[model samples]
Target: MVEIIDVDAENVDKYGFFCMRSKPNSDGYQKKLNWVKERLKEGLKIKIIQENGRQKGFIEYIPGEFTWRAINAKEYMVIHCFWIVGKGQGRGFGSQLLNGCIDEAKQLGLSGVALVTSEQGWLPNKKFFERKGFKMVDKIDEFELMALSFNENSKPQFYDWNESAKEYKEGITVFKSDQCPYIQDAVRNIIEASKDLSISVQIVDMDSYDVAQKKSPTPFGVFTVIYNGEIITYHPETKNRFIKMINKKNLLTNS
Candidate 1:
């Protein structure tokens, strides 16, 4: 008896219930949810499942920028969040919600759909996606990235790294900030592993605008996986874009 419906302002509480179950009590979980709800801008797709007239579960999806690196720019779809209430499970509500997402992808004319899944241990069951024809598209350490492609011909795009120090040899150009531990670590790994490669990672102090304006500082450091001027992505869920100017080899990324 599960029925999926669109997300509305008044019934967000239902969606909140599902999200809390997915992530549980954290420092600023509630605040973050409220903020996202209030400030959601474009390309947000949401649905709620009601079983026998009772709220059972919900789902929220968006572009791949927030979830995985966007390997394909022609089109992208992402599942930002999903959950089923305690009492709603074991009653087949999960299948209904996933089906809704599939139908939604088709309706939106999307090339594919992707999501970051913590659907393991106490989170959503890992098999939840398998039942819906999704496959483990990629992985970055522990982050489980899954995707469901509607198109028959889907191949992920890869990035080529730059390895020329002719631009800045003495400035000690570090590619990351401590703010983003992943980027920081990638920088560390490259600098540390430079003994094995031709590139050296160094910390450079520059204005935020300089970082923004310059192409070398685009990959913000958190989820972006870059090394030696090449992009390393196991997750296509988030948007991983590297824009370089000609043969200069200064790479930039955002998302």
Candidate 2:
């Protein structure tokens, strides 16, 4: 039988968060661990599925008010990350992990469970939630805000971004947080690439979940690259790809 383990301060150091197991000693790991520690005090919850002493999956969540996504999720439970890897896929582990979140939301007396999904990127697909009875409440760009509401009258909403993107008028701006272990390296790569291409770059490290929810130019709210006040991508790309994107944007602007 696979066992689900809730990560806490006592055991967090012993197990990886299911993404950065290889680089446990890296700066990204330390940063993400610290971030998780802080969020725990604010009601963050993480559960890992262990099968035969190996971690196969994990889910991260928090009270809706502390979710990193730019949405009005107050009185709801927000899922931040959910993943089932390798042999864990297609074995009902996904449903188990999701159900764990749903059960917790019910216990907390929240309005419901909410999560952000995308057709691409690091987020989960919408089909999984839809199959579990989540409804599409809102959408921004390519992202969808889905919710399983216990209250029929309550409708959560996505944050306004049209004006937020305008905050940075020029230059390549990266809005990021330590929520993901990979973002530290991605941020470094962008900085190096900017130097090579002689482009001005701004890196905004969202130190708190509130900052991310309020200031992120994109709804994904974890890592977003904005070029000349327009979003380029929400996920990290190779250094070469980053350079090419900047060059292409420059060409179009200069043309």
Among these predicted structures, which one has the highest TM-score? 2
Deviation in angstroms for 38 in model 1?
Answer: 4.5
Give the TM-score of each candidate. 0.50, 0.97
lDDT of 2 by residue, 130-218 (tens): 98999999997788999999998887789887577777877889999999988988898898899998889999988877888888888
Q: Give the per-residue Cα lDDT of candidate 2 at 156.
A: 79
So what's the TM-score on candidate 1? 0.50
Error of 2 at 252 (Å): 2.8
Candidate 2 global TM-score: 0.97
CA lDDT of each prediction against the hidden true structure: 0.47, 0.88
- List, in order, the clash count of every candidate structure: 16, 0
Worst 10 residues of 1 by lDDT: 238-247
Residue ranges of candidate 2 with Cα displaced over 4 Å: none
Displacement of residue 161 (Cα, Å) in model 1 is 14
